[model samples]
Target chain A: MEKNQILSVAISGLLALGLAGTANAADNKPEMEKCFGIAKAGMNDCSGSKSSHSCAGQASKNNDPMDFVAVPKGTCNKIANGSLTDGGGVVKKAM
Target chain B: MPASKYTFPCVAGIGLRAPHYREVLETLPELGWVEVHSENFFGGGAPLHTLRKVREHYPVSLHGVGMGLASATPLDEKHLSDLSQLCNDIQPVAVSEHLCWNAATGFVINDLLPFPYTREALDHVTRRVTQVQEKLKRQLLVENLSSYISFSQSEMTEGDFLAELTQRSGCGILFDVENLYVNVRNLGVDAEAFIKTIPADAVKEYHLAGFSERDGCLVDTHNHPVYNEVWDLYEHVLKHLGPRPTLIEWDTDIPALPELLNEAAKAQLIIEQCHD
Candidate 1:
């Protein structure tokens, strides 16, 4: 009886280890989120902005600040015309 | 019969995030090329308009993240058609997608999930790859994916499967060196041996990105800069496999244009030195 119990416990432990190993494999999500947060902070810091900014509208080449529907009053033209705030290094259009 | 015209310049390119669209076009950062996710710009209006403008300035490449080609469920024809349309509109230098599957019939996980890699799976993937290539009318660059689990059902190694796919479908391989490194640290894969198995000529592009350590394994999280070891392996591959069009990918915590370009420039310099 004692021997059987010991064998069962050992088997269970091995199974647990295998399951854990599989779960902790190559997941890119958590680190990717962390990197994105850091990049956002880096962009804000580099461009001297206090609040978050969206690149989808302002980064457009047309530079018609009016073309973007939700341009923040202070931030849009405040960023130079050809000087874009996004990471792709595109220059904004002139005001 | 210009082979190089179908190819990209042997220079550094940036992942064209929406943030720097105007700045990039107006100033024309001396970049070799630019790449954007096809799904992100699938919808018209602003995204398409911006991509069109950027396309004018730089040689763009379309990279797809959510094809789920090896899924147990059927292929997403809508997604494939969208990609085909984008390819036609953009006329990108290259088009690529991840190797792992994501959509199961009932449930669709947005993450790139690995499978058993059995003969059955290979047959499924090969068929899907052929379908995608035929639909697009261009050779698709299939990237190797990073995985967290290994199924006992696997009959072949990932390298062998990829080699077979290349041979059967006439597809180009986008060897993500970072992914191979992560697999080695996490799953005891022999990176050098894996490299040896692949047909060097079939490999048209190389991907370098950063990964973070998880428990005892490493995950291919594209949030950080290219690590030293990955760079070293890339150098080795370039020397042995020969210089291919290399991309510096940072999907998460993406830095500023200059910072990202700097990373790309580092890769570009290494790539240039390898050929010399």
Candidate 2:
């Protein structure tokens, strides 16, 4: 079927159901840990309070310098090279 | 999302952010309403799915951060179309955008920049807002912007600009009280003059957010809780314009959901006081 037809059918089906399915099963998110030195540009959580750019979004580094990543709790130390801290700005980027 | 017949209630709500999405969806706390940035759920991805689920529970408001309504360049058609699609899927109770510009002839500024409130700008913004409303098929709420710089070439004040924008475009106003406070501190804009100039009836909603101070400049960072002085100003605004659908927005460095609700409770108390 064409795109518009498919959309119409889906919307019609949804409206016909008169309140779609019940809200998805509760998000039961896992206990995640922040693994330093892995996050790509514009994708990681806050760098840290000490950093100038402390809100959401990863820092854009002029170099390949790692920024940190969030993995499930208790797995950061196991990564090839993941620490809990910024290692004295070695991984942090210039704001 | 159910085809909502409900209008925005005259109560306080929270700007729903990503960090608390699961908690909000699962627990469905005692929130008056929820306002989400319209750009986040544009392409029917996980965000849109989450928003659809949210729409089932709350009267969501589609607040656009990237509309660039008053930009000197032509309005971004793709952005407008994406917003219109989101509206169709969510059917928000109210839709709002900032009264500022982001795009220019060559490059686009990511932040909301204040413009000179000139007659030419008035006509330009009016036409663009009209275009947006025609596409969305509903009234758009244009929120006043927080400014760091002011144009010396401006003919009138920001309040006058907003008042004129509403009249010329047939749009409602989403008066962000915190933005007004920032302007008053940074630019010496008279709060009383602003409060008196804008038509009270044109105001459809009120945005209450927190700001951070950097080098003596009050920035609308939305990372802190509503401050005491801003709350005082909100009281003044409510007394003048009466209570509207107020929202507590904490965009950056967002705290826990309870913290947000606590702020909303404060606004709710003030709204009740003004109503009484």
lDDT of 1 by residue, B133-230 (tens): 99999999998878767888899899999999999999999898888888887778899888998999899888888877655667666778899999
Give candidate 2 misplaced runs (Cα > 4 Å): A1-95, B1-5
DockQ for candidate 1, please give it. Answer: 0.01
Collision pairs in model 2 = A37-A68, A38-A68, A39-A68
- What is the C-alpha lDDT profile of model 2 across A2-93, one tens digit per residue? 99999999988766565554432333442322222112235545232222221112212245646786455665656653543535434545
Q: Which window of ten consecutive residues has the lowest lDDT sum in model 2 chain B?
A: B1-10
Best by TM-score: 2
Interface RMSD of 2: 8.9
What are the iRMS values of all candidates? 11.8, 8.9
